[model samples]
Target chain A: MSAAGGLPRTGSALAIWPALRRSGLGPGLLMLAVVTGLNIALQPDFFSGASLSGNIATFAPTILICVAQAVIVLSRELDLSLGAGVSLINCVMASLPQDKVGGPLGVMAIAILVAILLGAVNGLLVAYAGLPSLVATFATGAIWFGLALTIMPQPGGVISDAIGDRYAGTLMGIPVPLLIIAVAMTGWAILARHRSGRRIMAVGSNPQAARDAGIPLRRTKLLAYLVAWILVALGAIAISAQTLSGDPRLGTSYTLASVAAVVIGGISLGGGRGTPWGALVGALVLGLVTNVIYFAGIASSWQEFVKGLVIVAALGFMVLEGQRRA
Target chain B: MAFTRRGFTSAGLGLASVAALGGIKPSQAAAPVTIGLSNGYFGTEWRDQMIDASKTQFAMYENQGLAHKLIVQQAGPDTAAQIQDVRNMIRSRVNVLMIDANSATALTGVIHEAKRAGIPVIAFDQAVTDPYAINVGIDEYDWGKHYAEWIVAQLKGQGRVAVMDGVPGHPAAVARRTAFMDVFAKNPGIKIVWSGYGMWDQAKAQAVMATVLAATPHIDAVCTEDGMGLGIMRAFQAAGRPVPIMTGEAQKSFLLAWKKERDAGHDVHLFARSNPPEIGRTAVGVAVRIAAGRKLKPLPDNTYHYPIKVEVTNDNLDQLLASVADKPDGYFLGEYLSESELDKLFV
Candidate 1:
C-alpha cells in the first residue's frame, strides 16, 4: 500500500510500515516509557496501588478528551471548544435538581444529548458555513464557556456523593478510571476499522482527492465532530463526578492540553496521520511528567517552566522524526 | 594540610551553633515538626506577601525549636494541581497541612483523606468546606461589613454603589459580597447599580471599572476588596473623575495613593482595612500548636477568625503611613497576631 493510503491497514505487511510511518506510535510509546521510568525512579510510591489509581483517576478526563481531539485532528480539524463543551455539560449536569429534574441518571442522559447537539453545532459551522474549524470552534467554545458561567456563576453545585464515589472507586481490582480509558481506546480501535473510519482518514489526508473518489466530505467531517463531542461529554461527566461539583471554569485547561496530547502522541496537526492510542499514550506521558517533576523536587516556581520545556522538546522530537521519515 | 585534622573542630563548631539555637529551652525540643504549605494561586502581590510572611515565621519557629522545616509548593490556578500538591504533602508525611485552598468545596475529599491519615488540615485565607479542616483567617463577612458600614456612612445611608468583588463564588468573595448585600438591603435607600468580579486581578479590575464607569454615569462610592482597590482607584484617575469615597485594603500602593489624593485636597474619604497576609504566619502558629496536642479555644464554627489590626482612615492615615514608611512600595501593611496574642487561643 502507498504511504498516501491515509488510514493504516490492519494485520497486513503494509499495515506495519504504514502504521510505523504515519502514526508516530513507536516514538510516542518510547517517550511514554522513558517518562514512566523517570517517574518510578524518582517517586517511591509510583507503583503503589492507591497512588496509581488516584493519578489515573485525575488523568482520566485529559485522556478521554485527547482521544476526541485525536479524532478531530485526524479529520484535519480541531475542536477548541472541547474544554468549554465539557465545562458546559458539567455546569448543566450540576445545575439540574435531582428531585425536580428526574435525578442524576436523567441529568446524565440530558448531558449526553447536549454534547451531541453541541457537536452538531460545531459540525454545521465547519461543514456548511465554511468557517475555519479553528476560528469556528474558538468562537463556539467562548459561547459554551459563557453559557456555563451563566448557569453556574460560581463553583457550587452538588453532584451527589454516590456518583462521586463511583467515579473515584475501583472496579474488580482495576481502577474505574483506567477501565473507562480502556473502553474508550477499545471503542476507537473498533471504529477505526469501519468504512466510515477509513473515510475519516481519507478526508483528513486529502479532502479534494477524497471528494474526487466520491467520498461524502461534509458528512464524514460532521461525523468526526459528533463523535468527538460525545467523547468530550464523557470527559465532562468524569470530571464532574471527580469534583462532585460544578465549576464554570472547570476544564478550561483541557482545550490546549488536548491539542498538546494529540501532537505529543505523534499525530500531525496538518492532516490525518496518527492513532488515538498514540494520543492516549501522549496523555499518559504528560501525566507522568507532572508526577516526575514533583518527585524530582524542582523548585515550585520552575515547575510550569519545566513542563513547557518538556512539551516543546516533545514537539521538536516529532518534527525531527518527520524530517527523518521524509 | 591542617584542614583534615580540623574537620572535628568544624563539626564541633556546628554542634556549638546547634546548641546556641537550642539554648532557648531544651525542654521545648521535641520531635521536629514538618509543616507543608500548599498554595494554589501565585503571581499576585498579596500571595507573594503571604508566602514571605509565612517563610519569615517559619524561620522564627525554627530558631525557637517550634518547627524543623517548612515545605511550600505553589502551582498556578488549577484545583486538580492543587489537590495533587496536597497529596504530595501527605505522602511526604508533613505533621501539619496548611493549605490556601483554591476552591471552597473542591478540596473536601482530599481534606477528608488527610484527616483519615491523622494530619490536621488547616485551610487559611481561602477556606475549604470540609468540616474536618480547621478553617482560619479573618472573617470574610466581617471584612466586608466593616467596609460596607463605611460606604453606608459615606453615602449617608443612600447612594449609587458599584461593587467590585473578588473571584466570584470564592468563599471569601462570597462571604464579603453577601455581607455587603445584607447591609445595603437593610439601609433601604442604598442602591447597588453595578457589580463585577475582578478575579482579584489588578489589571482586570481596572479594565472592568473603566467600562463600568463609562456605562454608569452617577456613582457615589465603589466597594472593592484587596488586590483590586488600587486598580479601581487607577481607573477613577484615568477617567478624570474625582476619586469617590471607596473602601480600601492595607496595601502600600493604595495607602500612598490615598495620601497623595488627601494631600492634594481631593477629599479622599478612604476607609481601608488590612487583610493581613500575616494570617499565613498565624496559620502556622495555629497548626503547630494543634500538632503539639495543645487545645484551641472553643469556637462556634470550625473557623478561627484571625484579628485585624489596621482599619485606616484620614485620622489614622499618618500613623499607618509611618508604620509602612520604611517598607517597599509593594509592602502589605497587615498584622499577624504575635505568638503571645495567639496564645490566647490556646487552652
Candidate 2:
C-alpha cells in the first residue's frame, strides 16, 4: 500500500507481491482479507444497500481516527487527546446556533479550526515545551473532556439532517462514508509527498540524526500533529453525521481504539514505518471482527473476551511476520 | 454462492414449516418471533440482572412457543458499536429489536434504518428520542420526584442537602436531576449544599461523596440515585459521621446496609425506589406480544411507561430484606408484570 504512494512501480505483479509483503502493511492487509472473507461468509446480505452503508458509516470514524493516530505515531508522538479533541469538536459543532453565521457550513469550518487549535496545543506542549507526548496529551485529554462536558453536560444537541443524510446517503452511486475515507486517504497521500512529511518520518525514525542533518525537529513534529488533528476533526464530523447529535462522551472509545488500530496495522510504535492506508485496513479489520463475532452467534458473555483474543492473535501474527522477515 | 442460495431457500422453507405448525394452534395466530436485544453499557450489576431477567422471560416464551429465539448483543459505552450491533440483528432478520441505547439521539439514524427494514424497535432503560421506536421504561422523573419528596418530607422541607447524581449527561440521570431540582425549588427552605455526578457506580459515588463531605459542613441529608446509596452511607461511616436521612435504591447492598444501620441504633431514616432491572423483562414481553400481531393501544408520544412496582422505606425495609435473603450483595430488587398484567396495554 505504501508502494502505491508514487513509488516507481515494478512492471511485474510478482515483483509487487514481494514488495507489498515486505512492507509494514503486509500483515494488516492479510488480516483484512481474512476478516472480509469471514464477514461475507457469515452474512450473505453484507453487500445489501442498508447493510453496506451501515457498515461503512460505522467503520468510517474509526478509520479516520486510525489515520489521524497514524500521523502522530509516524512522527514518534502519541496524542491521547485526539479522542477528547473529537468529543470537544463534536460538542462545539452541535452547540453552535443553526441560525447563526452561515449555519451548518460555518459550524463545520469552526469545528475544523477548533481541531487545528487543539492539535497546536498538543504539539506546542510536546514539541516546544519539551514535555513527553504521552504526558502532555494525557493531561490535555482530560482538559478537553472537561471542556466538552461543560459545553454539553448531557448528550442533546441537534445537527442538521442534511449532514447526516448525506453522510448516510450515496453521492453519484458511491457511499458518502466511502468518499470520506477516500478524501482522508488522498489527504494523507498529498501529505506523504510533501517535504514536511519526510521530515516527520526522519524525526520519528531518528530524531538526533535528523536534527544533526539540519531538519527542524520541533516544527516537523508540530506539523505532524496539525495534519493528524485535521483528520481527527474530520472523524468527529463523521461521528456527528452518523449520530445527528453531539455527545461529550461520544469519542471515548476511539482514544484507545485508534492506538490499537495503529498497532494492528503493523505500524511501529516507537517511530515511523507504516502508511495511513494500513491504518484504514486495520480499522476495517477490527470493525469486521466484531461483525464476524456477532454473525457467528457468539454468546454475549463471551463477546468481549473473544474480541480481545482475536486482536491479540492478530498482533501476534504481525510480530511473528516481522521476526520471520528479520 | 450457490451453496448460500440453497441454504437460504432451506431456511425459508424451515420458517414456512414453523408457520404451518403454528397455524394449528388457534391461540398462537402468529409464528414464534425471534427477539434481538441490543444492550449498551453493560458495566453495572443492574444491566447484568436486566439481561438475566430478559433471558428468563425469553425462556418462558420459548417454552410456550410464543418466541423462537432471543439474540442478545451486549457491549460497552460506544454508540457506533451499538448501532453496528443493531444492524447485525437486523441483517440476521430478528423479528424485533430491543435496545438500551448509549445515546438518546445518536441512534436515530440506525433506528430509522431498522424501521425502514420493517423491524420495530423497543427501547428500554435509556430510551432513544426517535419517535419510530417505542420506549418502555419507568417514568424517571417520577422516580426522582418520589425520592426528592421523601427527602423534603423527612427534612421538614428545610436542610442542607448534598445531592449525588448518576452519570452526568445521561438521559435518565438528566430527567431525574430535573425532578430533583424541581421538587427542591418548590421548597425554598431546602438548600442544596453540593451537587456532583457519581457516574452510577458505587466506588465513584463513595469517592465523590467523600470529597463533598470533606469540603462541606453540615449536610443534613444526601439525595442520590440508585446504585450509589450504599457508597454514600459508607462515606458517612468512614468519616465517622452520623448517617443522615438519605434516598436510596432497591439494591441488596444498600438495604442490607440500612438494616445493619437500624440494628446498630444509628437512627437512619431512608427512602428508596426500585429502578427494576426487570424492566428489560417487561420489554421482552412487550416485544414478543407486538411481534405476534398484538395491537397496542394508542400511546402518547409512542412511549409505554412501565409502572414502578416497589419502594422501600423505614416501614418495610425488614420485609424486603427477608424476601431477598438468598440474593447476593450486588442483587437489585425488581419485578416484572405477568402476561395477564401485560395484556391490559394492548387492544
- Top lDDT hit: 2
List runs of model 2 lying over 4 Å from the truth: A1-17, A317-326, B1-31, B214-217
Question: What is the fnat value (0 to 1) for candidate 2?
Answer: 0.73
Best by DockQ: 2
Give lDDT per model, in order.
0.81, 0.84
lDDT of 1 by residue, A1-326 (tens): 44435554565665566556556776777788898999888878878877788788778888999999999999999999988898899889888885676676777788889999999999999987889999999999999999999998888787776667777787897788888888887877788899898899999989999999999999999999998888888888888876777877777888888888887788888767888887788888877777777678766887767667757876887887766656
lDDT per residue for candidate 2 within B1-347, as digits (tens), equals 01111222233343344433332121445556899999998867999999999999999888878789999998788887887898889888888899999888888878877876778788998878878788899999988999999999999989999998997788899899999999999999999999988988888899989988998879999999888998899999999899999998899999988999999987889989998999988999888866765545678777878888788988899999999899988899988888777777755
| lDDT value, residue B205 of candidate 1 | 92
Q: Residue B3's C-alpha lDDT in candidate 2?
A: 14
Candidate 1, TM-score of its B chain: 0.89
* Model 2 Cα lDDT, one tens digit per residue, A1-326: 34344445567755666566545777778788988999999999888887888788889989999999999998999999988898999999888886685876887788899999999999999999999999999999999999999999888788887788888888899998899889889978887889888888889988999999999999999999999999998899988887888889889888888988887787777886777777787788889989988988886657667657656876786677656655
User: After superposing candidate 1, which stretches have Cα over 4 Å from the reference?
Assistant: A1-21, A99-104, B1-31, B158-160, B189-194, B197-199, B211-218
The DockQ assigned to candidate 1 is 0.39
- How well does chain A score by TM in each candidate? 0.92, 0.92
Clash count (model 1, backbone only) = 0
